[model samples]
Target chain A: MWKWLHPYAKGEATYRLLGAWLPWLAGSALVTLTVGLVWGMLFAPSDYQQGDSYRIIFIHVPSAMFSMGAYTAMAITALIALVWQIRTAEWAIAAIAPVGAVLTFIALFTGAVWGKPMWGTWWEWDARLTSQLILLFLYIGVLALYYAFTDARTGAKAASVLALVGVVNVPIIHFSVYWWNSLHQGATITKFEKPSMAPEMLIPLLISILGFALLTGALVCQRLRNEILKQEIHRPWVHAQLGVAEQER
Target chain B: MAFDSWYDFIDMGGYGFYVWLAYGVTLLALTILVMHGLRTRKQLQQQAVQQQQRQQRLARRKQQERGTA
Candidate 1:
């Protein structure tokens, strides 16, 4: 139950846990991404309509999905921090912000590149596009707010509040295409029924999605460890770890 | 494979520019983020080591002052 999570609430325990998970996350991410990208880019048949341009979906859909996923993770961590007063949860918010921001940027960029050939324009003010853009701003806002204050506690508190407020945007981004007549297409993988895509295309897309998720996991672990080090700099455990790290060097 | 030759693959059925650009940009951004994370972690550990050393020096000086006084 919740009891198992109790150990990870401690900074040192969480740090070790992330350390244990990093190699596995990184290795799987590498394997899946390579296989997925190669299969999607080369072997997958061209779309009957869009032809080879559809290959962008391999990266675009995964990045777009994980962008929202990262924000949702941040909101959960923020809730944990506020509700339980967990310092490690607070550090997780900082760990996730920039990665989510980058994912959002990738989504926007890839969507634009995909749009140019399909929609005849680089951008549109459609619901889906604009909502995702706002998501990018929200991530930046959380990051900016986290560092704006001189006091770390006050900064984390303010940033956690902002993250909680920003949770509202995740749903908006997901539903924007449906809520308004938009240029952006509806779901390909997340449809209520089976995916609209064929298995040839869909399989690699799913693999790429797994790759993106795992890569994000590895990146977050690295960032969380860094956050722990930064916050626990004056603690003896941090000093001992650093000394050991030096000896290993 | 979808393409018959190197040229055909590179062309990507005339959508090559868009496809490659998207992939290239995504790879570049992710690489930068990963590299930055690794570099920052090393720097922070170094900074922590320095801070620890400084604290040790300060403590030794305080102990010496108490002994002489």
Candidate 2:
């Protein structure tokens, strides 16, 4: 496994790996998001309680879901970089942070939009809402810290430690509704039990979730590939492939 | 299917503001992420190519100078 993983840990190999997977991720994301969101808003039956407003669930839930997911992913990458001492992993931390920050922003934006009618307010200080807001700050902090230092290595080290520490908030965000009597609703789909929603409503949401996941994968892969190119531009392999640097003399 | 007509669909059963707002914000954010990533990647790729060219130019200059010497 070490031998298998070591090669891919190199910038070029990882770039190729990401390139190979990019198409599948993009294709699946395109198909799923189109089908899921369209059908969700148009064809899926309206909810008994929230009516058409509940259709927002298609975006809100998925964005919120991925916000936490991206954080966890970043934390894992930080762990990999720290433990394995991999430059690619550190680059991945930089690549992942921006996307994660954007996803967190999406989650917060959609959540606020969803809240206005349901909770009768655009903003709330409830546990679930508050913790999720904090998650956004943590993401911003990661990005900010990443660019704070003159040396990227130093910046990444600081960001990695922050990401590792911020992971504790992920669970708090997840279980906050359960932990407190919050205005936000409790979990719709938990692992241990059946989903609370009907098939028509649940199916579209599940599809949207998959779509969002695929989109995230595609974006991350593309970002990683770009980071590899930028970081490894001076490497012999990169120069050899370009064939422009060595010939210009 | 959920609405009686196009207007009703747009109205989103009177929650149009909230529903559309949520979807709109989500889509806008997605678009921003995509555009930003693409633009940054392109710029980085361009920078990489330019740097490579500069390196090659310097290398050739040195080799030519050495050959002449």
Candidate 3:
């Protein structure tokens, strides 16, 4: 399996792969986000209990959910790099960290803002909120560790170890509401049997989620290409790629 | 659709501050992130081109020195 996948792990191959997919991701993100946000803000009916405040769910829930998803994704890339010694996967770790960190920040900030009206406070120490805060710290910690060493390869390994350990927190973040008494609401969209939201409310939320996921994908691909160029700048393939870019310019 | 008029939608049933703030902050953060990533890539690509051009100049100079010798 390693041998077969090894060729595609090279920097040039990965660069081409990302370039090919960038347009599709960007287009989908734009379309889905426009439709979803418009539908959410103007079309979806207000919740009986929360009224218009519930509309924040469209942005808040997607960022909150994707932050966890991004962390899990970064960790999986780290694991692949560790186990298979793939350099592209290592670059992917760096590419994903900042994006995940920002998503986590958005989630935390939006949650706090939403909390003021809903919970009557800007902050809390509930298990879910605390765990989510810790998740943000975990992302910053990985990025910090990755850049700490002057030698990037060593830093990548160090960061990969941290990401793997942080994987424990991902599951903790997901189940914290279930495992303890918390002010944060329980899972709504992920409840397979029946989502707590009405279909009109749920559809826009789901669309926003898809839009956010595509946006994440587009950002990661852009970063990954940048990383590859930075690391592979001296390679012949990189020079050839640059030659084409120069001509096109 | 839920609002009776434009003012009512903006009023958000008296929760406009909380809802708008959340959406606004999220949009601002995401925009900042994407822009930063793009700017970094642009800088790196420009640097790569400059470095390549410098290396080529040095190689050409060395060849001329060899020919003179």
Candidate number achieving the greatest lDDT relative to the actual structure: 1
Q: Where in model 2 is the C-alpha error above 4 Å? A: A239-249
What is each candidate's DockQ, to 2 decimals? 0.82, 0.69, 0.71
RMSD of each: 2.2, 1.7, 2.1
lDDT of 1 by residue, A1-249 (tens): 679989898888898899999999999999999999999999999999999999999999999999999999999999999999999999999999999999999999999999999999999998899999999999999999899999987888899999999999999988887888998888986646878899999999999999999999999999999999889888888888776343311
Query: How does model 3 score on DockQ?
Result: 0.71
TM-score (0 to 1) of chain B for each candidate = 0.87, 0.92, 0.92
**Clashing residue pairs found in predicted model 3:** none
- Looking at model 2, residue A216 earns an lDDT score of 90
Interface RMSD of 2: 1.8
Over B1-69, each residue of candidate 3 has an lDDT whose tens digit, in order, gives 778999998889999888888888888888998898789877776777777776677788898899999
Q: Candidates 2 and 3: which is better by DockQ?
A: 3
Per-residue lDDT of candidate 2, residues A1-249 (tens digit): 898789988888888788899999999999999999988988898888888888888888888898899889999999998887888988888888888888888888888888888888989898988998899899889989988999988888899999999999999998898888999888899899999999988988999999999999998998888878777877766655544444423
TM-score of each: 0.95, 0.95, 0.95
Give the whole-model CA lDDT for all candidates, comma-separated. 0.92, 0.86, 0.89
Q: Measured with DockQ on alpha carbons, how good is candidate 1? A: 0.82
How far out, in Å, is residue A210 in model 3? Answer: 0.8
